[model samples]
Target chain A: MQPTETFFSGFAPHDLWFLGEAALRTLWLSLLAISIGSMIGVVFGWLLSVSRIGGGFVLSPLLDIFRSVPLIIQLVLFYNFAPIIGLRLDAFDAGLIVLIVYTSANVAYVARGGIEAVSQPMRRAARSLGMTYWQDMRYVVWPIGLRAVFPAWVGVALGVMKDSALVSVLGYVELLKASQILITRTQETILILAIAGAFYFALSYPISLYAAHLEDRWNQ
Target chain B: MDYNFHWRPVFKALPDLLQAALLTLEVAAISMILGVLIGLGLSLIRIHMKGPVMWLASIWVELARNTPALLQLFFFGFGLGAFGIHFSPYLIVLMGLTFNNAGYLAENFRGGFGAVPDTQIRAARSLGMTAFQTYTRIVIPQVLRIVYYPMTNQMVWAVLMSSLGMLVGFRELSGETQFFASRTFRIFEYFAVTAVIYYIIVKIILGASRLLAMRLFRY
Candidate 1:
């Protein structure tokens, strides 16, 4: 088939509406997942830094297991296992849950780094000032730690967005799955895929650019 | 459906799964080697290449870095076939992974290269070394030392990303697991086994890389 023939044939008028809906779903799902994931990551990360179990030599290996496992495998496990535990969710929910768990693992690591970046002198000074641990953390340590690791957090956020595409395999009507559906129905494989790629770029590039700006601004 | 946990089927599948695991390693190793070379070249261009070459390299790096590898794999696997250009699924997956890894690796390498102190380069030049010799003798070695940990992390990430190849029918570990699960209706057993395999592979790679880095780059 001629490339143009394939391209033109693939651009069905009605499919545009379907693609739009899919795009919206993808964006909504991704935003929700990332927001929740970030929360989990922040909390877990803070715990990792402050908790006694998180402080010792065992911390590295504990984090290692979370870091080493693939997010896709984690998703598959959740997708299959969630129903068995009475918390039944559709593909989208399962995907979001897995995203939270997987990205939290990363966030915990980033958060730990952020916490560590808070200088010892600062913590000592906070203690000397009669600030309680919570007060010191809330008023001083967390601020510095957050600033130090904001760039990495942004990168992780972007990672969550991109990794969201993996959820398409679980039958979520994500952008990639939408494109795959279009490809199968119309067989305009390249054009639709390119459009899908463009959609992903549209979704992710702005956040990345924003991250670059924040990194520069924060570093300055 | 009662989930029956059977060790026999999982054990019976081990040899085939091991073969698949070996293929996964083969693909990852080849892709990483190529990715490192491409990433090094790209880093050089980003740092030193003049004019359009630099601009193009930066754009490539940004585009690849921002995009998901799964989309890239699909594009290479399915998109190219529409244009009368065909490669095996394995090659397409490899190319996709290589490009993805190269972009990240380029950034890592650039960071490493930038971390090298200017004084060291100056000292090398002052010793009558040419630019190339100075880079190879002094700058590159030091940069590698600085970037060893991050590079190892990226290599681990590369191994994990290889799981996405299953989506394109490349029959890596994940692919084999999915196949067996579907055929046998042993979802948990198959996935759990493969997950364990993946964890083992990652652990071994991480451990090996750490030792190798310590030996190679120890000051």
Candidate 2:
């Protein structure tokens, strides 16, 4: 494990491929968490919007814990705590669990906001048009509410992707962790970091720009 | 799940953990102050300047905003070390957090500045106020007011983000927790306590911000 003189190698051609694979891991991890967590979050968000006392008293504070504490702590806590609780989970699973809840906590608020953005009169109009409650929700609320919060949800998704770097603490070989490993072996810190940063920027910047564009268009 | 929980070790380390928590707050506070100052300068540069310096500011803002914070910390840690410029872990964390905060705050400041209409600057200029006077007395105050809530949220973000200090070997709250958990092997218990401390810290920051907002914005 000692980084002796010969142990340190220069960056080689294959290193780019290594980084690409690691980037894929980051993508999949965040994608899994966002998709599943969004589903759960939207349901909970709907509940929160409909039931003042139940959601406020019970679910809101429950989810708020994930928001308030640092993701690093939550990752560490869940990773270590899982073994004690007989979960027998590995790093990826533990990281995924924490990421899922963190994503859900965030998406819940956005989903609730999206739900609330559809005015009462609008929902009532849909209902008075002989639509059932579910029909009103599915036909009327979802479209308008989604447009209002799509940008925010994109922000959350990007935030979670960047925050996935913290999952490296659990020894998951995501993009950042892969860079750390390469830095140790190659001793090419700046080069490897630049490459890794480019990978992230390539992934993040265009999405953010597109989100901004959509927001501008919608606002207009 | 037959694991015996050990609260005693965590309780014994409570004072040290609390002290580390204070260090976390201190670093976050210092970074926030530095971030706001640098961010103000950066936003001004973006607004008033062109060419390489403005491009540099944009790159700084975009890179910091787009990249992972831990990667930025590593850039300060080992990336700088590659050039024979070394920093203590504490400085690495401080610099990294400040750099990230500055990037984010700069964007917020730009948005805040954009919210102020062109007419106000014109009015301030027409009053024969110097450029400095116009910005200091007229423009900056309004921008600050517009960005006050965002600044508060950013402060909360700074506190939470400082937990990354542990990765760089800085003995902040999360680092200290990791240290104790390693020693006592009471990982769950120690982190549970640490999480509560963080929650309290966030709540206090939010409460104080609200109270300060009441006083400062009572027009």
TM-score of each candidate structure, all chains considered together = 0.93, 0.96
Candidate 1 at B83: error in angstroms? 1.1
Runs of candidate 2 exceeding 4 Å displacement = A1-5
Give the DockQ (C-alpha) for candidate 1: 0.67
Residue-level lDDT tens digits of model 1 in A103-214: 7778888988998899899899999999998899899978888889888888888888889989998999988899898888788888887777788788778877887787
Candidate 2 lDDT over A1-220, as tens digits, reads: 8966586778999988998899999999999999988898899899889888889889999998999999999998888888877888988999999999999999999999999999999999998899999999899999999999998899899899999989999999999989889989998899999999998889899999999899999989
Which parts of model 1 are misplaced by more than 4 Å?
A1-9, A54-63
* Per-chain TM-score (chain B), model 2: 0.98
Model 1 TM-score (2 dp): 0.93
The TM-score measured for candidate 2 stands at 0.96
Backbone clashes for every candidate come to 0, 0
Local error of candidate 2 at B104, Å? 0.8
Docking quality class, candidate 1: medium
Error of 2 at A46 (Å): 1.5
